[model samples]
Target: MALSTDHFSPSPDAAHLRARLSQAGLRATRQRLVILESLLTLPGHPTAEQVHRQVVRQEPSISLGTVYKALDSFVAAGLTRRVAAAEGTSRRYDADCTEHHHLFCTDTQEIIDYCDPQLDTLIREFFAAKGLQNFQPHSFSLHITGSKLANK
Candidate 1:
Protein backbone atom coordinates (compact mmCIF):
# COMPACT_ATOMS: atom_id res chain seq x y z
CA MET A 1 0.00 0.00 0.00
CA ALA A 2 1.19 3.46 -0.80
CA LEU A 3 1.82 5.67 2.22
CA SER A 4 0.38 9.16 2.50
CA THR A 5 2.61 12.15 3.15
CA ASP A 6 0.08 13.71 5.54
CA HIS A 7 1.07 11.60 8.49
CA PHE A 8 4.74 12.27 8.05
CA SER A 9 5.15 15.82 9.29
CA PRO A 10 7.89 17.67 7.48
CA SER A 11 11.27 18.06 9.11
CA PRO A 12 12.31 21.43 10.53
CA ASP A 13 12.66 23.91 7.67
CA ALA A 14 15.23 26.64 7.24
CA ALA A 15 13.21 29.25 9.14
CA HIS A 16 12.79 27.00 12.16
CA LEU A 17 16.48 26.18 12.13
CA ARG A 18 17.28 29.87 11.88
CA ALA A 19 15.14 30.58 14.93
CA ARG A 20 16.81 27.77 16.87
CA LEU A 21 20.22 29.07 15.96
CA SER A 22 19.27 32.58 16.97
CA GLN A 23 17.95 31.35 20.31
CA ALA A 24 21.17 29.40 20.81
CA GLY A 25 23.24 32.54 20.19
CA LEU A 26 24.51 31.33 16.82
CA ARG A 27 24.34 32.90 13.40
CA ALA A 28 22.15 30.90 11.02
CA THR A 29 24.47 30.62 8.08
CA ARG A 30 23.80 28.22 5.21
CA GLN A 31 26.37 25.74 6.49
CA ARG A 32 25.09 26.04 10.03
CA LEU A 33 21.53 25.41 8.90
CA VAL A 34 22.50 22.25 7.05
CA ILE A 35 24.64 21.08 9.94
CA LEU A 36 21.91 21.75 12.49
CA GLU A 37 19.33 19.91 10.41
CA SER A 38 21.64 16.91 10.20
CA LEU A 39 22.16 16.90 13.94
CA LEU A 40 18.42 17.05 14.64
CA THR A 41 17.46 14.28 12.23
CA LEU A 42 20.17 11.86 13.33
CA PRO A 43 19.06 9.34 15.95
CA GLY A 44 20.67 8.98 19.33
CA HIS A 45 24.12 10.55 19.79
CA PRO A 46 26.39 10.79 16.75
CA THR A 47 30.08 11.53 16.25
CA ALA A 48 31.49 14.40 14.21
CA GLU A 49 32.36 12.12 11.29
CA GLN A 50 28.86 10.69 11.22
CA VAL A 51 27.33 14.16 11.21
CA HIS A 52 29.71 15.28 8.47
CA ARG A 53 28.76 12.29 6.32
CA GLN A 54 25.07 13.13 6.61
CA VAL A 55 25.54 16.82 5.89
CA VAL A 56 27.81 16.14 2.91
CA ARG A 57 25.07 14.12 1.22
CA GLN A 58 22.85 17.21 1.27
CA GLU A 59 25.55 19.80 0.56
CA PRO A 60 28.60 18.31 -1.12
CA SER A 61 30.56 21.50 -0.76
CA ILE A 62 30.44 21.25 3.02
CA SER A 63 33.65 19.65 4.20
CA LEU A 64 34.27 17.41 7.18
CA GLY A 65 36.46 20.20 8.54
CA THR A 66 33.52 22.58 8.34
CA VAL A 67 31.36 20.14 10.27
CA TYR A 68 34.05 19.90 12.93
CA LYS A 69 34.29 23.67 13.13
CA ALA A 70 30.50 24.13 13.28
CA LEU A 71 30.19 21.45 15.95
CA ASP A 72 32.81 23.22 18.06
CA SER A 73 30.86 26.46 17.68
CA PHE A 74 27.66 24.69 18.67
CA VAL A 75 29.35 23.35 21.77
CA ALA A 76 30.51 26.82 22.72
CA ALA A 77 27.02 28.26 22.24
CA GLY A 78 25.43 25.44 24.30
CA LEU A 79 23.52 24.29 21.23
CA THR A 80 25.09 20.85 21.60
CA ARG A 81 27.34 19.03 24.02
CA ARG A 82 29.93 16.27 23.68
CA VAL A 83 29.17 12.88 25.13
CA ALA A 84 32.01 10.63 26.26
CA ALA A 85 32.44 7.59 24.07
CA ALA A 86 34.26 4.33 24.78
CA GLU A 87 37.91 4.69 25.69
CA GLY A 88 40.09 5.69 22.72
CA THR A 89 37.13 6.34 20.46
CA SER A 90 36.12 9.64 18.86
CA ARG A 91 33.95 11.94 20.93
CA ARG A 92 30.18 11.66 20.36
CA TYR A 93 27.81 14.62 20.14
CA ASP A 94 24.39 15.01 21.75
CA ALA A 95 21.94 17.79 20.88
CA ASP A 96 19.82 17.27 23.95
CA CYS A 97 20.79 19.95 26.49
CA THR A 98 18.67 18.64 29.37
CA GLU A 99 20.20 17.42 32.62
CA HIS A 100 20.25 13.64 32.55
CA HIS A 101 22.48 10.59 32.84
CA HIS A 102 23.55 7.98 30.33
CA LEU A 103 23.96 4.23 30.14
CA PHE A 104 26.93 3.24 28.00
CA CYS A 105 27.02 -0.25 26.59
CA THR A 106 30.63 -1.28 26.41
CA ASP A 107 29.95 -4.11 23.99
CA THR A 108 28.20 -1.98 21.37
CA GLN A 109 29.62 1.35 22.51
CA GLU A 110 26.13 2.84 22.49
CA ILE A 111 25.01 5.67 24.73
CA ILE A 112 21.48 5.45 26.11
CA ASP A 113 19.82 8.38 27.82
CA TYR A 114 18.71 7.49 31.33
CA CYS A 115 16.32 9.57 33.40
CA ASP A 116 15.26 8.88 36.99
CA PRO A 117 13.62 11.47 39.19
CA GLN A 118 14.46 9.48 42.36
CA LEU A 119 18.10 9.27 41.43
CA ASP A 120 18.18 12.97 40.72
CA THR A 121 16.64 13.71 44.06
CA LEU A 122 19.06 11.45 45.94
CA ILE A 123 22.11 12.99 44.34
CA ARG A 124 20.92 16.52 45.00
CA GLU A 125 20.19 15.66 48.62
CA PHE A 126 23.54 13.99 49.11
CA PHE A 127 25.38 16.96 47.66
CA ALA A 128 23.27 19.41 49.62
CA ALA A 129 24.06 17.55 52.82
CA LYS A 130 27.75 17.12 52.16
CA GLY A 131 29.23 19.41 49.57
CA LEU A 132 32.89 19.59 48.59
CA GLN A 133 34.96 22.11 50.48
CA ASN A 134 35.28 25.35 48.45
CA PHE A 135 33.92 23.61 45.37
CA GLN A 136 30.47 24.20 43.93
CA PRO A 137 29.15 21.66 41.47
CA HIS A 138 27.19 22.96 38.49
CA SER A 139 26.22 19.91 36.39
CA PHE A 140 27.23 16.26 36.25
CA SER A 141 26.34 13.00 34.55
CA LEU A 142 26.84 9.59 36.12
CA HIS A 143 27.41 7.40 33.08
CA ILE A 144 26.82 3.74 33.88
CA THR A 145 28.97 1.49 31.73
CA GLY A 146 28.22 -2.18 31.14
CA SER A 147 27.63 -4.74 28.42
CA LYS A 148 24.14 -5.00 26.93
CA LEU A 149 22.67 -8.42 27.49
CA ALA A 150 21.18 -10.42 24.65
CA ASN A 151 17.47 -11.07 24.83
CA LYS A 152 16.04 -14.53 24.21
Candidate 2:
Protein backbone atom coordinates (compact mmCIF):
# COMPACT_ATOMS: atom_id res chain seq x y z
CA MET A 1 0.00 0.00 0.00
CA ALA A 2 2.95 2.28 -0.42
CA LEU A 3 1.45 4.87 -2.71
CA SER A 4 3.43 6.37 -5.56
CA THR A 5 4.03 10.07 -5.10
CA ASP A 6 2.47 10.78 -8.46
CA HIS A 7 -0.78 9.11 -7.51
CA PHE A 8 -2.19 12.31 -6.05
CA SER A 9 -3.68 14.95 -8.30
CA PRO A 10 -2.48 18.49 -8.22
CA SER A 11 -3.99 20.86 -5.65
CA PRO A 12 -6.10 23.93 -6.32
CA ASP A 13 -4.51 27.23 -7.16
CA ALA A 14 -3.25 29.60 -4.47
CA ALA A 15 -6.25 31.92 -4.82
CA HIS A 16 -8.73 29.15 -4.05
CA LEU A 17 -6.61 28.00 -1.17
CA ARG A 18 -6.45 31.52 0.16
CA ALA A 19 -10.21 31.85 -0.07
CA ARG A 20 -10.70 28.59 1.80
CA LEU A 21 -8.33 29.68 4.55
CA SER A 22 -9.95 33.07 4.78
CA GLN A 23 -13.43 31.54 4.99
CA ALA A 24 -12.16 29.42 7.85
CA GLY A 25 -10.94 32.52 9.67
CA LEU A 26 -7.33 31.64 9.13
CA ARG A 27 -4.82 33.93 7.50
CA ALA A 28 -3.23 32.58 4.35
CA THR A 29 0.32 33.00 5.61
CA ARG A 30 3.16 31.72 3.50
CA GLN A 31 4.06 28.94 5.93
CA ARG A 32 0.46 27.79 6.31
CA LEU A 33 -0.15 27.94 2.56
CA VAL A 34 3.04 26.03 1.78
CA ILE A 35 2.28 23.39 4.39
CA LEU A 36 -1.28 23.03 3.12
CA GLU A 37 -0.10 22.78 -0.48
CA SER A 38 2.28 20.05 0.50
CA LEU A 39 -0.46 18.17 2.30
CA LEU A 40 -2.93 18.48 -0.55
CA THR A 41 -0.39 17.35 -3.13
CA LEU A 42 0.74 14.27 -1.23
CA PRO A 43 -0.80 10.94 -2.15
CA GLY A 44 -2.09 8.79 0.67
CA HIS A 45 -2.17 10.07 4.23
CA PRO A 46 1.13 11.51 5.40
CA THR A 47 2.42 12.25 8.86
CA ALA A 48 3.51 15.70 10.00
CA GLU A 49 7.16 14.80 9.51
CA GLN A 50 6.50 13.73 5.96
CA VAL A 51 4.65 16.97 5.29
CA HIS A 52 7.54 18.92 6.81
CA ARG A 53 9.97 17.14 4.51
CA GLN A 54 7.93 18.14 1.49
CA VAL A 55 7.50 21.71 2.65
CA VAL A 56 11.21 21.98 3.28
CA ARG A 57 11.84 21.50 -0.41
CA GLN A 58 9.80 24.62 -1.15
CA GLU A 59 10.51 26.69 1.93
CA PRO A 60 13.86 25.59 3.17
CA SER A 61 13.67 27.88 6.16
CA ILE A 62 10.37 26.46 7.45
CA SER A 63 10.74 24.60 10.74
CA LEU A 64 9.13 21.31 11.71
CA GLY A 65 7.39 23.12 14.54
CA THR A 66 5.90 25.55 12.07
CA VAL A 67 4.53 22.70 9.97
CA TYR A 68 2.95 21.10 13.01
CA LYS A 69 1.36 24.37 14.01
CA ALA A 70 0.03 24.89 10.52
CA LEU A 71 -1.44 21.40 10.51
CA ASP A 72 -3.16 22.12 13.80
CA SER A 73 -4.55 25.27 12.38
CA PHE A 74 -5.76 23.46 9.30
CA VAL A 75 -7.53 20.89 11.41
CA ALA A 76 -9.13 23.55 13.56
CA ALA A 77 -10.25 25.47 10.51
CA GLY A 78 -11.93 22.38 9.03
CA LEU A 79 -9.52 22.46 6.12
CA THR A 80 -8.21 18.99 6.98
CA ARG A 81 -8.55 16.17 9.42
CA ARG A 82 -6.17 14.28 11.69
CA VAL A 83 -6.63 10.59 11.08
CA ALA A 84 -5.49 8.01 13.57
CA ALA A 85 -3.31 5.30 12.12
CA ALA A 86 -3.14 1.73 13.38
CA GLU A 87 -1.81 1.18 16.84
CA GLY A 88 1.74 2.45 17.45
CA THR A 89 1.78 4.44 14.22
CA SER A 90 2.14 8.15 13.76
CA ARG A 91 -0.97 10.21 13.09
CA ARG A 92 -1.71 11.12 9.47
CA TYR A 93 -3.46 14.07 7.85
CA ASP A 94 -6.19 14.08 5.23
CA ALA A 95 -7.16 17.18 3.26
CA ASP A 96 -10.42 15.73 1.98
CA CYS A 97 -13.18 17.22 4.07
CA THR A 98 -15.98 15.37 2.33
CA GLU A 99 -18.21 12.85 4.07
CA HIS A 100 -16.51 9.55 3.51
CA HIS A 101 -15.35 6.40 5.28
CA HIS A 102 -11.87 4.92 5.47
CA LEU A 103 -10.41 1.55 4.59
CA PHE A 104 -7.41 0.99 6.75
CA CYS A 105 -4.97 -1.73 5.79
CA THR A 106 -3.43 -3.18 8.90
CA ASP A 107 -0.47 -4.79 7.18
CA THR A 108 0.63 -1.74 5.25
CA GLN A 109 -0.87 0.91 7.54
CA GLU A 110 -2.30 2.68 4.56
CA ILE A 111 -5.68 4.40 4.60
CA ILE A 112 -7.91 4.66 1.56
CA ASP A 113 -11.14 6.58 1.09
CA TYR A 114 -14.38 4.59 0.91
CA CYS A 115 -17.79 5.83 -0.10
CA ASP A 116 -21.08 3.91 0.22
CA PRO A 117 -24.48 5.47 -0.06
CA GLN A 118 -26.22 2.34 1.17
CA LEU A 119 -24.06 2.12 4.23
CA ASP A 120 -24.65 5.78 4.94
CA THR A 121 -28.40 5.36 4.68
CA LEU A 122 -28.38 2.21 6.82
CA ILE A 123 -26.40 3.88 9.57
CA ARG A 124 -28.57 6.95 9.56
CA GLU A 125 -31.76 4.92 9.63
CA PHE A 126 -30.54 2.71 12.44
CA PHE A 127 -29.51 5.68 14.51
CA ALA A 128 -32.69 7.59 13.78
CA ALA A 129 -34.73 4.64 14.94
CA LYS A 130 -32.98 4.72 18.28
CA GLY A 131 -34.44 8.19 19.02
CA LEU A 132 -31.96 8.93 21.74
CA GLN A 133 -32.80 11.80 24.06
CA ASN A 134 -30.71 14.96 24.05
CA PHE A 135 -28.48 13.56 21.30
CA GLN A 136 -28.12 14.81 17.76
CA PRO A 137 -26.23 13.21 14.90
CA HIS A 138 -24.11 15.45 12.76
CA SER A 139 -22.24 12.97 10.59
CA PHE A 140 -20.85 9.44 10.51
CA SER A 141 -17.95 7.56 8.96
CA LEU A 142 -16.85 3.95 9.14
CA HIS A 143 -13.30 2.69 9.49
CA ILE A 144 -12.89 -0.81 8.11
CA THR A 145 -9.64 -2.48 9.07
CA GLY A 146 -8.13 -5.23 6.94
CA SER A 147 -5.28 -6.00 4.61
CA LYS A 148 -5.23 -5.04 0.95
CA LEU A 149 -4.93 -7.79 -1.58
CA ALA A 150 -1.91 -7.63 -3.83
CA ASN A 151 -2.43 -6.71 -7.46
CA LYS A 152 -1.63 -9.29 -10.06
Candidate 3:
Protein backbone atom coordinates (compact mmCIF):
# COMPACT_ATOMS: atom_id res chain seq x y z
CA MET A 1 0.00 0.00 0.00
CA ALA A 2 1.24 3.45 -0.83
CA LEU A 3 1.53 5.62 2.28
CA SER A 4 0.64 9.29 2.38
CA THR A 5 3.74 11.37 3.12
CA ASP A 6 1.87 14.33 4.59
CA HIS A 7 2.51 13.40 8.20
CA PHE A 8 6.24 12.90 7.77
CA SER A 9 8.44 16.00 8.05
CA PRO A 10 11.22 14.64 5.84
CA SER A 11 9.62 12.03 3.65
CA PRO A 12 11.25 8.62 3.80
CA ASP A 13 12.55 6.78 0.78
CA ALA A 14 9.98 4.13 0.04
CA ALA A 15 12.20 2.13 -2.30
CA HIS A 16 15.07 2.01 0.19
CA LEU A 17 12.73 0.97 2.97
CA ARG A 18 11.29 -1.77 0.82
CA ALA A 19 14.78 -2.94 -0.09
CA ARG A 20 15.76 -3.04 3.59
CA LEU A 21 12.70 -5.08 4.44
CA SER A 22 13.43 -7.41 1.60
CA GLN A 23 17.08 -7.77 2.65
CA ALA A 24 15.96 -8.59 6.17
CA GLY A 25 13.63 -11.28 4.79
CA LEU A 26 10.56 -9.42 5.95
CA ARG A 27 7.46 -8.75 3.88
CA ALA A 28 6.86 -5.13 2.99
CA THR A 29 3.35 -4.44 4.19
CA ARG A 30 1.53 -1.14 4.44
CA GLN A 31 1.50 -1.21 8.24
CA ARG A 32 5.17 -2.11 8.44
CA LEU A 33 6.12 0.58 5.94
CA VAL A 34 4.17 3.23 7.80
CA ILE A 35 5.65 2.18 11.14
CA LEU A 36 9.20 2.07 9.80
CA GLU A 37 8.82 5.37 8.03
CA SER A 38 7.54 6.97 11.22
CA LEU A 39 10.49 5.60 13.14
CA LEU A 40 12.97 6.84 10.56
CA THR A 41 11.45 10.28 10.16
CA LEU A 42 10.76 11.11 13.78
CA PRO A 43 13.52 12.83 15.71
CA GLY A 44 15.14 11.10 18.72
CA HIS A 45 13.95 7.79 20.11
CA PRO A 46 10.15 7.49 20.06
CA THR A 47 7.89 5.14 21.95
CA ALA A 48 5.42 2.85 20.19
CA GLU A 49 2.58 5.12 21.21
CA GLN A 50 4.28 8.04 19.54
CA VAL A 51 4.72 6.02 16.38
CA HIS A 52 1.08 4.98 16.46
CA ARG A 53 0.00 8.57 16.86
CA GLN A 54 2.08 9.67 13.90
CA VAL A 55 0.92 6.80 11.73
CA VAL A 56 -2.77 7.15 12.48
CA ARG A 57 -2.68 10.82 11.57
CA GLN A 58 -1.94 9.80 7.97
CA GLU A 59 -3.38 6.30 7.90
CA PRO A 60 -6.38 6.35 10.16
CA SER A 61 -7.32 2.80 9.24
CA ILE A 62 -4.24 1.42 10.93
CA SER A 63 -4.82 0.27 14.52
CA LEU A 64 -2.63 0.76 17.56
CA GLY A 65 -2.32 -3.01 17.93
CA THR A 66 -1.03 -3.18 14.35
CA VAL A 67 1.50 -0.48 15.15
CA TYR A 68 2.72 -2.45 18.18
CA LYS A 69 3.05 -5.60 16.12
CA ALA A 70 4.90 -3.78 13.35
CA LEU A 71 7.33 -2.36 15.91
CA ASP A 72 8.04 -5.84 17.26
CA SER A 73 8.57 -7.08 13.72
CA PHE A 74 10.92 -4.20 13.00
CA VAL A 75 12.94 -5.01 16.10
CA ALA A 76 13.10 -8.70 15.24
CA ALA A 77 14.05 -7.91 11.65
CA GLY A 78 17.00 -5.77 12.85
CA LEU A 79 15.51 -2.66 11.24
CA THR A 80 15.25 -0.95 14.62
CA ARG A 81 16.56 -1.31 18.17
CA ARG A 82 14.69 -1.05 21.45
CA VAL A 83 16.25 1.04 24.19
CA ALA A 84 15.19 0.09 27.70
CA ALA A 85 14.84 2.74 30.37
CA ALA A 86 16.95 2.54 33.52
CA GLU A 87 13.98 3.33 35.76
CA GLY A 88 11.94 0.46 34.35
CA THR A 89 9.82 2.85 32.35
CA SER A 90 8.44 2.34 28.87
CA ARG A 91 10.97 1.36 26.23
CA ARG A 92 11.91 3.63 23.32
CA TYR A 93 12.68 2.63 19.73
CA ASP A 94 15.70 3.75 17.68
CA ALA A 95 16.05 3.42 13.91
CA ASP A 96 19.82 3.80 13.90
CA CYS A 97 21.20 0.28 13.96
CA THR A 98 24.84 1.48 13.94
CA GLU A 99 27.15 1.09 16.93
CA HIS A 100 26.72 4.07 19.25
CA HIS A 101 26.01 4.93 22.88
CA HIS A 102 23.22 6.97 24.44
CA LEU A 103 23.28 9.84 26.90
CA PHE A 104 20.05 9.69 28.84
CA CYS A 105 18.76 12.65 30.80
CA THR A 106 16.93 11.49 33.90
CA ASP A 107 15.40 14.92 34.49
CA THR A 108 13.87 15.38 31.04
CA GLN A 109 13.69 11.73 30.03
CA GLU A 110 15.67 12.54 26.91
CA ILE A 111 18.06 10.24 25.07
CA ILE A 112 20.98 11.54 23.01
CA ASP A 113 23.36 9.55 20.82
CA TYR A 114 27.06 9.65 21.78
CA CYS A 115 29.89 8.20 19.68
CA ASP A 116 33.42 7.79 21.03
CA PRO A 117 36.07 5.54 19.47
CA GLN A 118 38.28 5.45 22.57
CA LEU A 119 35.42 4.37 24.82
CA ASP A 120 34.37 1.67 22.38
CA THR A 121 37.95 0.35 22.07
CA LEU A 122 38.45 0.40 25.85
CA ILE A 123 35.24 -1.54 26.52
CA ARG A 124 36.05 -4.09 23.85
CA GLU A 125 39.61 -4.52 25.13
CA PHE A 126 38.45 -4.87 28.73
CA PHE A 127 35.88 -7.48 27.71
CA ALA A 128 38.49 -9.29 25.63
CA ALA A 129 40.90 -9.36 28.60
CA LYS A 130 38.22 -10.82 30.86
CA GLY A 131 36.73 -13.33 28.51
CA LEU A 132 33.38 -14.93 29.23
CA GLN A 133 33.08 -18.68 29.73
CA ASN A 134 30.37 -19.39 27.15
CA PHE A 135 29.33 -15.96 25.98
CA GLN A 136 30.59 -14.36 22.77
CA PRO A 137 30.70 -10.59 22.46
CA HIS A 138 28.72 -9.21 19.53
CA SER A 139 28.56 -5.47 20.27
CA PHE A 140 28.41 -3.09 23.24
CA SER A 141 26.82 0.31 23.81
CA LEU A 142 26.91 2.41 26.96
CA HIS A 143 24.00 4.45 28.31
CA ILE A 144 25.11 7.25 30.61
CA THR A 145 22.31 8.79 32.66
CA GLY A 146 22.32 12.37 33.92
CA SER A 147 20.47 15.67 33.62
CA LYS A 148 21.20 18.03 30.73
CA LEU A 149 22.47 21.40 31.84
CA ALA A 150 20.43 24.44 30.87
CA ASN A 151 21.79 26.92 28.41
CA LYS A 152 23.36 30.06 29.92
Q: Which has the greatest lDDT?
A: 2
Candidate 2 lDDT tens digits, 77-106? 899998888554687888888888888888
How does each model score on lDDT? Answer: 0.83, 0.85, 0.82
| 1 versus 2: better lDDT goes to | 2
Expressed as tens digits, the lDDT of each residue in 85-118 for candidate 3 is: 6454787898889888888878878778887788
Model 3 residue 78 lDDT score: 90
Error of 3 at 94 (Å): 0.4
The TM-scores, one per candidate, come to 0.89, 0.90, 0.89
**What does each candidate score in C-alpha RMSD?**
6.1, 3.2, 6.2
Better of 1 and 2 by TM-score: 2
TM-score of predicted model 3? Answer: 0.89
By TM-score, rank the candidates, best first. Answer: 2, 3, 1
Please tell me which model should have the higher lDDT, number 2 or number 3: 2
User: Which residue pairs clash in candidate 2?
Assistant: none
TM-score of model 2 relative to the true fold? 0.90
In candidate 1, stretches whose alpha carbon ends up further than 4 angstroms from where it belongs are: 1-10
